[model samples]
Target: MVEWFVGVQVVIAVLAGTAAIVVGLAGVKPNDYTLGATLLVEALLVVQLVMAIIAPAFGNVATGSGLEFWIYLVSAILIPPAAVMWGLIERNRWSSVVLGVACLSIAVMVYRMSQIWFVQLA
Candidate 1:
């Protein structure tokens, strides 16, 4: 993955994580603004998924073993939506809690993804 994209993802992840925490702390009422912002984070992941596929396809080693990296990228893409869906099923503060946790986690996955690519590149 490009450094710029990782930078963006990191920035958004931090912001979304903060928003999630705020939402969770404020109680069960869903904030439209926060949800909108959260969707942006997911959208960013979706972009990462697309880029992951393209970068590898073009013989670029954004992450080593392009296909394998994509698998991890795809998993990262799946997690937030699944968490959100699970939250919806419950329809309470816990959903926000899930989202909050998911928001924090993607950053770690992003870092792992970075390591996977860079460690091998080195």
Candidate 2:
């Protein structure tokens, strides 16, 4: 994983998640703003997926378990679309909250992936 890119992803995820949560709490239903934010997060995850596939070819390698890193990366990539689908189907304020929850979860997972790429084990 690219260190700076990981930071960018986490920042975007937090911002998007916070916005979605606030919209939900205000009783706003799933709409363009919320859905768009979720999509933006998903787009970033897709970029991260591509980066992960190619980074090693350029000499960047994970210091931790490759399987663990890939698992977290793949799972994180899946979350936003699932949340967006649920939001589209439900069309409710709680769905917006669900999107928020998914974004926040992705943020945590991305951070874990970064650790698996960069952190040293004993």
Candidate 3:
């Protein structure tokens, strides 16, 4: 729900997406940097998740309950790891592209999560 954190996610997603595209155009196969991006995003999402918990604990009530918040939390936790692991299985630069897509998707999700948290209405 933090405005600052949503900005962070957008920045991360754009940077990661750019790298993924550049890597794809270069024809190098996927490498450790892809994993690096995964880790970077995971760190950001963890920030979001922690903040999500704290906001309500501090009595910042949303129209929904904490469980709704955790759905986004769990989704954010689960999706990037799955994408990173899938990139490992696929083993192509194209797979990095896929991971980048996931990164962008998470950014979108984070924004949506903020809306779910911040807006007064459902």
Best-performing candidate as measured by lDDT? 2
Candidate 2 lDDT by residue in tens digits, 1-122: 79999999999999999999999989999999889988999999999999999999999988899999889988888899999999999988999999999999999999999998999562
Write down the TM-score of every candidate.
0.81, 0.96, 0.84
Per-residue error at 63 for model 3, in Å?
Answer: 4.4
- Which stretches in model 2 have alpha-carbon errors above 4 Å? none
User: What's the best-to-worst order under TM-score?
Assistant: 2, 3, 1
- Evaluate model 1: give its TM-score: 0.81
For model 1, what is the error of residue 43's alpha carbon versus the real structure, in angstroms, after optimal superposition? Answer: 1.0
Candidate 1 — which pairs collide?
none
User: Tens digits of per-residue lDDT for model 1 on 21-117?
Assistant: 7777778644555555567778988887777667756765753555666677788788877876666676677677678778778887887787777
Clashing residue pairs, backbone N/CA/C < 3 A, model 3: none
